[model samples]
Every structure is written in structure tokens, then in C-alpha cells.
Target chain A: MSTLIDILLLSLMGITALAAVRMKSLFGAVMLTGIFSLLSALWFLILDAVDVSFTEAAVGAGISTVLMLGTLSLTKSEEKTSNHSQIIPLFVVFVTGGVLIYGTLDMPDFADPLAPIHTHVAPHYIEKSGAEIGVPNIVTSVLASYRGFDTLGEVTVIFTAGVGVLLLLGIGRRREDGDE
Target chain B: MTHHFILRVITKLLIPLILLFALYVQFHGDFGPGGGFQAGVIIAAALVLYALVFGLNTASAVIKEWVLLVLIPLGVLIYAGVGVASLLLGGNYLDYNVLAHDPVHGQHLGILLVELGVGMTVAAVLTTIFFAFAGRGHRDANGNLLPHSALSDEIRNRKDGQP
Candidate 1:
């Protein structure tokens, strides 16, 4: 049953990807991407990465769809037709994809208990976190307790991104330009 | 879609629920399958939806741009402040074990504070990005700039693009 679901979701994702690529209208393409993200989130759920699935659903499917729509509104609806050849970009993408897959070949299987990553600190986290942190969700304990420094860095990166956007555009017209 | 009555009504009904859900995701994250990052995006998405149905002006009125700017850094401060607090408590940087008489309770307290920080920063930043993008004036034919509130029908109805 799980295998069937995986096949169905993966096929749908492939269809969505193809639709987005073949779509001439940028609006349609953006919507297709949103659908793609939703499918990805569902796939993540099936993989037992519930926390990851939640983040993907909210951030990838929900927020990114809105952001992409905002971006699409700023530009032309129809994708501009270009005489430039697509072969070079296509070749580059293919090469990159091939290299990524090749790199993954050396990695452990999905959720392999004996994998180096699992053999490492994960065992400690799974074992000791309950007694040490006392949090029902180990992911939370791991993220906020065991690796608080990394989360601090992530927050700083988010802070920097917001500041950069402020410098570039600023939050709208500051409510004083008399323009709604 | 200012005149979109159904959308307007639906948005009015949905915004509170969305916001409540965001908060739930934020506070309930420690026990559930969510956290600051997910919750933050959910909160921003609620405001974005409001802006979409009602208008950016109304949405910004609810959450002023300056407030977001202040929160952007304030969240980082809150997160780092916890670390500093832990440090002052005679633990290493971000070390929660020494935060209280009991290490587990300290972990709980530290995790909540830091997650709050993360949620705040993520929510503010995403909303600011939405405001920046949607706040820009749309360009029309003949190289004339049309204010966002008055985007030309041609662009507004372009295969039902975002309004």
C-alpha cells in the first residue's frame, strides 16, 4: 500500500513538473509549482518525517505559493518568447542532475538504522533526549536544546534576509504617502 | 478583487482561524510535528491572504511595517538573549542544562524561548517580503506606472493573475 502511494505521488509530481515546464502562461506555471510543492509535502508525510512534512507544507506549499504569486503580479502574465537556444541551459541542468544523483549513490538507504548518520549521535538523541530534555517531541529537543547554536545561526540568517529586503524595497510606502 | 464580495467575506471569516492555527502551531510545536519555522510561515500566510482579499493597506495597518522591522531583529535578540542568559547562568553558550535547578525544566524553558524567537523572526520577515513585492506599482503599456491599487484591467485580468 505504501509503495502504491509512493508511485502515485511521484507520478503526480512528474506530471506537475512537466506541466510547469510546458506552460506558456506564467500564471499557470506558478500554480503548477504550488501543486508540486503540495505533492512534495504529502510525499514527506509518507516518509515518516512528520516535522519535515509540516514545514514543507506550510513553507513550501502555503507561503511560497503566495510569494510566487506576488512576484508573478509584478511581471508579464505570458512568458516572453525568446529566440535564444535552450540547449545550453538544458545541458547544464542535465549535468547537474546527473552529478547530484551520482553523489547520492554513495549515501545510505532511507531510514537505514545502521547507516553512519544513524549510528552516530542520533542514537544518543533518541535514547537520552527523553530523560534529559523531557520533551515529547525529540525533534524539538534536538533543534532547540541539543543544537541551539545552529538554530541561532538560522535565526540570524532570517534576520539578515529581512534586513536585506528592507534595504532593497522597504515595507511598502510606509503608510504616509497618502496612497493605499 | 476589492469588490469580490465572496472572497472578502471568506477572508474575514478565515483570517482569525488562520492566525489562531499559526499560534497553535507555534506554541504546540514542542509536543507536535511543527515548530517556529512552520508556524511563522503560517502566520505570514494568513496576513498575505488578508492582503489578497481586502488590501495591503488594511493588512499593513494591522501589522505596521516598522513593527515588523523591529521584530525582525528583536527575535534574533530574544534567541541570542536566551543563550546569553544560559551563559550567565554558568553554562556554555546555548547550554540549557544549567538554566535551572532541574536540567529538564531549563531545557523546556530555553526551547520555548528560542522557538518563540524563531517564530517571530520568520513571521515578520516573510510578511515584509510580501509587502515589498506587492507594494510595488505595476507598469502599464506606454511605459506608464500604475499604482498597485489601480493596476490596469489588462494586467489584473491577465489569465486570472494575482490581484
Candidate 2:
């Protein structure tokens, strides 16, 4: 049953991706992209990467959709494809996909406790994080304390994006000017 | 548009619960899956819902643009301030262990402050972005910009009689 479900989910994801990329209407493409993100999030959840799934759902399905829609609002909704061919993009996609698939072949079986990641620093952190940080969530402990600098960098990136948006929109303008 | 009976009743019931859930998520991060970021988004989404029902202008009146502007920087400052405090307390930057006499207590205090900052900045910025997008003119049912007056008078006249 689980295998069947997984196969169905994978097929759906493939269809969504194709639809998202191939749609001629930019608005439809953008919305399909959001659906693709949402389906990917569901896949991540099924794969038991709950934290990653949450991030994907929020950032990919939510924020990226909003950002794309905002961009669409500023531009034409219809995509005009002319005599220009997509040969280069197709080649690039094929090569990238092949490389990724080849790389995955060497990976440990899914959810294997004997996986290198589980045996290495992960066990140490899992065993020691409660004592060291007193936090129940090992992910949060690692994010906020052990690799604190990386999380700080992520926060800075978010802050920078906020600043970029404000700068592009202009900050001091009154709403009466219709620029707010 | 005037308030519908269902919307008015639903908003009154749901808004408070949403606000409460946001606060709970914000404070419960230490124990659960949610954190400042999720809480902030939830809160902002609630406001967005309110705006969708009550109109953007009303929501803006409640939140105010200036307040949001101040909030964005204030959140950044609050977050950075914790790091500075740690530095002053004889630790490296953002070493939350130094925030209090007891290292564990200090860590707790620092996390709280930082989370508060994160929540503030996220909520403010998300709402601001929504406001900017929602206020824009788009083609209406008749395929003309909703506020036709914003266009030139000649252009408006040309398009008016046709559709």
C-alpha cells in the first residue's frame, strides 16, 4: 500500500512539474508552480523529513507563490513563445537530472538507522543536546547553538531581502501618491 | 462593501483565537514544532484575512504604515541588541550563555528576546508586502483597470463606451 502511494505521489509530482513549466499563461504557470511546491512538501512529509517539509510548505508554497504573484502583477500574464527554441534548457535539465539520479544511487537506504549520518555527529548531538542546550528539539539546539552562525546568516539573508523589497518599493512615500 | 452577517460573526469568533494561537506558538517553541517564524506568519496571515474581509484601508488604519516601518527596524535592533548584550557580558557575539548569571537562564532569556525580534520583523514585513500588492490596480471583470480614473481621461473615455 505504501509503495503504491509513493508511486502515485511521485507520478503526480512529475505531472505537476511538467504542467508548471509548460503552461503558456504565466499566471497559470505560477499557480501550478505553487501546487508543485505543495506536492513536494507532501512528499517530504511522507519521507519523514518533517522540519524540511514545514520549511518547504511555508517558504516554497507560501512565500514563493506570493512573490511570484507580486511579480506577475507588475508584468504581463501571458507568455509569448516565439521562434526561439528550448533546446539548451532541455539539455541542461536532462544533464542535471541525470547527475542527480546517478548521485542518489550511492545513498543509504531510506530510514536506515545504520546510515552514516545517523551513526556520526547526529548520534552525539541527539544524545548530548538535551544536556548541553536543555532544549527538547535537537534540530533547534543545533540551529540556534551548535551551528549558530549559520542560522544567524539565514536570518541576515531574510533581513536583507526585506530591505531589498523596501528599497525597491521606496519607503518614505505617502499612500496618497499610490506608491505605497 | 458592507459587512455580511456570517463574516462579521466569524471574524469576531476566529480573530481572537488566531491571535491566541500565534502567541502560544511563539512561546511554545522550546517544546514543540512551532517557532517565531511560524508564529509571525500565522499572525500576519490572520491580519491578511481580516483585511480581505474588512478592506485594505480599514486594516491599514488599524496597523498604520508608520508603525510597521518602525517595527521592521525595531525587530532587527532587538535581535542585534541581544548579541551586543552577550558581548558586553564577556562573551563572543550572540553567546546567549552570558546573558544571565546562570548560563542556562541566560540562554533562555536570550532565546526569548531573539524570538520576539524574529516574530516582530516577520509579521511587519509580510503585512507590508501584502499591502503593496493588494493596493495595485488590475483588470476588472470588464477587462479594464478597476480604478479607471487613474488612467488619462482621454484613455478612459476611449475605453468606456466600447465595453
Candidate 3:
């Protein structure tokens, strides 16, 4: 039953992706991309990755859509037609996608008990996180406790990104006496 | 946007709820499917929605740009401060085990503080970026700097025979 739902969701995602690429209006493309994010969030929910799905829904669908619309407003709504051919890029994409699919063929089946991922340190974390972190959500424990440094690094990266945006957009002033 | 009565009313009703939900996600992250990153973006989105409906100047008035600038670095400082505190207490960097009398409680405290830092930085940065993007290219009737698209909306409202 879940597989059928997954298939339906995947097909819809593909349709949205295609629509986004095909649209000439950047606004429509941006909206389609938001829909694509929503579909992918649903896909993540079906995969039982609630945290990932939540992040996708909030960041991907919400913030990114607004950002893209802001970008569209700053520039042209319609995409300019390029004179160059798209054949080489299409060929490269196909080759890269094919290689990725071929690479995945060596991996274990979905949810296999003996999969390397299950047999790895995941089991140790799952078994010990409850006792060690005392948190109901092991994901939080793993992200914030076991991998605290990594999360700090991620936060710093976000901080840097914010600075970068401010720098690029010329909004780095500390006072209110400058141009908007 | 102010000219659109329905949009203004609906946004006024929705903004508080969105902000409340963002706070819930931020605090309840340890127990649920959310954390600082998601909560930060959610809150930023709420602010952006307010900017969209009420105009950027009003939003900026509510949250001064300088405040966001200070918050961007303050959050990083808080996160790093936790690490320094842990180190000073004879633990390694970011080691929450030594933060309190009990390791479990210490971990909880550390996680909450770090997540708060993350949330602060993310929200400040996103809001700042949105401001930059929306602030540019703002023009008045004679090509002077006005409050971006809100000027055009006001003109449209005036044209429609409304005060």
C-alpha cells in the first residue's frame, strides 16, 4: 500500500519538475519548484523520516519560495531565450544520472536487515542514545549531543551565509542613515 | 498591500499564529520532528509574510534592521560560548556531559542552548537577506527611493476612488 503511494508521489514530483523546467515565466517556475519541494516533503514523510520532511516543508517550500519570488521581482519575470544548444548539457545529465543509478545497484535492498548501514554504528547509537542523552528523540540526541560540533559548524556556516548575503546586497551598514 | 482590506485582515490574524507556531517548534524540537534550523526558517517565513502584506518599512519598524545585525553574531557567540563554558569546566569542546551535576541534565541544557543559538542565527540571517532583496530597486513616482512595491499599490488604490 505504501509502495503505491510512494509511486504516485514520485510520479507527481516528476511532473512538477518537468513543468518547472518547461515554464518560460520565472514566477511559474518558482511556484512549481515550491510544489516540487512540497511533494518531496511528502515523499520523505512516507519514508518515515519525519524530521527531514519537516525541514523540507519549512525551508524548501516556505523560505525558498519567498526568496525566489523576491529574486524574480528584482529581475525579469520571463526567462530570456538562449541561442546556445542544450544538447551537450542534456547528454551530460543523462550520463551522470545513468552512472548514479548504476552505482546504486551495488547497494543492499531497501530495509534489508543485513545492510551495512544497519550493521554499522547506527545500532550502537540507537541502543545507547536513550541511556546516555536521556532524550525521547534520538535524532535530537544524535544531532545536538553526539554531533554537537557538526551542528555548531552548520550554524556557523549559516551565519557566514547571512553575512555574505548582507555583504552582497549592500546592507552591511550599522546605522539607519544609508540608502535602502 | 494596505489597500487590500482582506489581505491585511487575514495577515494580521495569521501572523501571531505563525510566530507562536515557530516558538513551539523551536522549544519542542528535542521531543519532536523540528529543531533550530526548521524553526528558524519558519519564523523567518512568518516575518517575510508580514513584510509582503504590510510593506517592508512597517516590518522593519517592528524589527529594526540593527537588531537583526546584532542578533546574527550574538547567536554564534552564544553557541561558541557554550563550548567555551564546557571547556572551562574541564570538559572537551562542546562536551555537555560535564555541564551539570548529572550528564543527562547537562546534555539537555547544552542542547537547548545550542539549538537556541542556531535558531537565532538562522532567523536573523534569513530576515536580513529578505530585507536586502526587497529593499533594493525601490523607487518613487519620480524615480526616487520609496517603499518598493507598496507605493504602486497605494497609487492603484488612489486610482480606484478610495481614500
Candidate 4:
């Protein structure tokens, strides 16, 4: 029964991905992409990466959908049909997907206790984090401390994105005449 | 089109609770599934709801654009400042242990400060994006930027028999 459910979910994810790319209406595509993100989040949860799943659900399904819709509001709703099938993009996607799938074949099975990831840095963090940081959530400790530099970089990236949007929109610009 | 008794009463009751819940989430993130980002979005959503029901102009009065502009950078500075503080205390960057003489207390303080910063930035940025989209004077085929708004307005206009 569980296997059946897994297969169903996987198929649903595939269909959602296809729909997200192939939909003619831009709004429909964006919404379907959100569904794709949601499905991927569920997949992550099933794989026991609860923290990753939460981040995916929030940033992917929530923020990405909102950002896409905002962009859609500023542009056309319907994708223009071209004579060509966009061979370059198709080739790029195919190559990337093939490489990703090939790479996954060498990875340990999902949720494997003996996985290298579980044996290596993770176990050290899991065992020592409590004594070192006194934090129950090791993920938080790792994010804010052991990997503090990376977190700083991530925050900087977010700030940069915010600045990029502000520059592009000119939402808070002052007029040359200083008029409201 | 005018004020309704039920909505006015409900909104008045709900706004405070939403804000309180946001603060709770911001502080409780250390122990739970929520943190600054979620709290910020929830608060922004509540404000957006108020704006939607009242008017953009009215909401802007409560949360001025200038205030939001300041908040964006303020949150980032607050977050980075904590790290700087930690560095100044003779630890690596963002080493919260140096935030106070007692490492545990310092961690707690650091977490709270960063969470507050994250919440403020998230809320401000989300609302800013919402306002940018909603404030744009554009109309689709149904004469609304959003389908949900169009449907609600259609229902309201039909009740009022507006041209």
C-alpha cells in the first residue's frame, strides 16, 4: 500500500512538472510550478528531511509563487507560441536532468542509516552540538554557528535580491525636483 | 460600499490577535517550527487584509512607505550587527557565544535579535511587494488585477447596482 502511494505521488510530481512547463497561460504555469514545489516538499518530508521540506514549502511554494505572480502582473499572461520548440532550452534541460539522474544513482538510498552523510559530519554535529551549543535543534546551531559564514552569505544574497528588485521597480526613488 | 457592522467588529478584534501571534512566533522559534520569516509573513498578510478591506491609502497611513524603506535595511543591519558584536567580543563572526559573558545566555540573546531582524525584514519586504502589485493601476479582461478581487468586487457591485 505504501509503495502504491509512493508511485502515485511520484507520478503526480512528474505530471505537475510537465504541466508547469507546458501550460500556455503564464498564470496557470506559475500556479502549476507552485504545485510542483509543494509536491517536492512532500517528497522531502517522506524522505525524512523535515527541515528541508519546511524551507522548500515556505520559500518554494509560497514565496516563489508570490514572486511569479508579481512578475506576471507586470507582463503578459499568455506565453507566445513560437514556430520553434526552443531546442536550446530543451537541450539544456535534458542534459542537466540526465547528469542529475546519473549523479543520484551513486547516492545512498533515501533515508539510509549507513549513508556517508549520516556517518560523516552529520553524526559529529548530532553528537556534539548539544554539548557545544546547548541547542536542541542541531540544524539551527549548524546554520547559525558552525556554518555561520555560509548563512551570512545567504543573507547577503537575499539582501542583494531585495536591492535588485528595488532598483528595477524604482519603488522608493526620490524625484529630482523633490516632489511627492 | 459603506461600513458594515459585522466586518468592522471582526477586523477590530482580529488585528491585535494576529500581531500578538506574530510576536509569539518570532520569540518561540527556538523551540518550534516557526520563526521570524513565517511570523513576518503572517503579520504582513494581516496588514494586507486590513488594506484590502479598508483601502490602500488607509493602510499606507498606518504603515508608511518611508517606514518600510527604513525597515528593509534596518533589519539587515540588525542581523549583521549581531555578528559584528560577536566578532568584537573576540570570537569568530556570528559566534553567538560571545554575545554575553555566559555563552548560553549570549546564544539566547543572539537568536532573539536575529529573529527580530528577520521578522521585521520579511514582513516589510512581503508587504512592500504586495503593495507594489496591488497598487499598480492595471486591469485584466475582467477589469481587475486579481481574479479574487474581481469576483468580490463583482458581487459587491451587483449588490449596489453600480454601472
> TM-score (0 to 1) of chain B, per candidate?
0.83, 0.81, 0.84, 0.79
Can you write out model 4's per-residue Cα lDDT over A57-135, one digit (the tens) per residue? 7667776677778778777899988898789988999999999999999999866789887787988898997777776
| Residue-by-residue lDDT tens digits, candidate 1, B8-64 | 888889889999988988899889877888889889888888878767667777887
Better of 1 and 4 by TM-score: 1
Clash number for candidate 3: 0
Rank candidates by TM-score, best first. Answer: 3, 1, 2, 4
Scored against the true structure, residue B145 in model 2 reaches a CA lDDT of 29
* Model 4 ranges with Cα > 4 A deviation: A1-3, A51-55, A85-92, A174-180, B2-21, B48-55, B136-163
User: What would the per-residue lDDT of candidate 2 be over residues A126-163, giving only the tens digit for each residue?
Assistant: 89877767777666667666776676666666667777
Local distance difference test scores for all models: 0.83, 0.74, 0.86, 0.74
Candidate 4 recovers what fraction of true contacts?
0.14
Residue B133's lDDT within candidate 2 is: 66
Per-model TM-score on C-alpha atoms = 0.86, 0.82, 0.90, 0.78
lDDT of 3 by residue, B29-147 (tens): 88887778878888898899899888887888889888999999998999999999999999999999999999999999999998899899999999989988887645343322366
Chain A fold similarity by TM-score, each prediction: 0.87, 0.84, 0.92, 0.84
C-alpha-based local distance difference test score of model 2: 0.74
Best by TM-score: 3
Error of 1 at A4 (Å): 1.8
* Each model's Cα RMSD: 5.7, 5.2, 5.3, 7.0
Q: Comparing 2 and 4 by DockQ, which wins?
A: 2
Ten consecutive residues with minimal summed lDDT in candidate 4 chain A? A171-180
Write out the backbone clash pairs for model 3.
Answer: none
